[model samples]
Target: MKIPVIGRRDDTADTPDHPATDPIEELRAQLRRVCGGRLRTLDAEREHLDARRRGEAARMRRVGE
Candidate 1:
């Protein structure tokens, strides 16, 4: 004997009080939050390295002259 195939009901599902979020979007938001500080630190380091390289290049040019 075959039983009735009841369709899924969203209302029946146990959802939290907040709205549901897409998994991918949730992960992207998490990455943005976690990596934001690291990205800022990396940017500061890059600027420092660039300034050091420029200073070295200027020193070399003066030495050559």
Candidate 2:
């Protein structure tokens, strides 16, 4: 299951109070990157999420801890 929406703590850095990239523009850019000329918002989101999951999993792995 996916995470629930929750308020962020002050220490978070991933998002600014106001993000520079417009969501629609970012999605369009991702679509263009993934597909040569077609729309692919789902593909973009999936790729982004998979990459983040991989990074987080690697970060959480126990390595001589």
Candidate 3:
């Protein structure tokens, strides 16, 4: 997904030696890392939940018979 250029600063009009560099890239990189970590944690939780559900279903079937 392309990160939108919403917060980018326009530094083209500045003096030759004092041109502005965008700081938004650093923030974007940090956010990306945080999102990746969250996804990993959520995936692990989903796997754990699925396993529990399967174990419960098996127990229920045994009880019903």
Model 1 spans > 4 angstroms off: 1-40
User: Compared with the true structure, what per-residue lDDT tens digits does model 1 show for residues 22-56?
Assistant: 55555555566678834335788799899999999
Q: How big is the RMSD of model 1?
A: 12.4
Model 2, 1-65: lDDT tens digits are: 22212333233324675344545565676567668866646789799889999988887885535
Model 3, 1-65: lDDT tens digits are 43334466455425685354456654655566878834335788799899999999999999999
Candidate 2 lDDT at 4 equals 19
True lDDT of residue 52, candidate 2: 100
| Steric clash count of candidate 3 | 0
Clashes per model (N, Cα, C within 3 A): 0, 0, 0
Model 3 residue pairs with clashes: none
Q: What is the lDDT for 8 in model 1?
A: 28
Q: What would you estimate as the lDDT of candidate 2? A: 0.59
* Model 2: how far residue 7 lies from native, Å: 37
Give per-model TM-scores. Answer: 0.39, 0.34, 0.39
lDDT for 41 in candidate 1 is 55
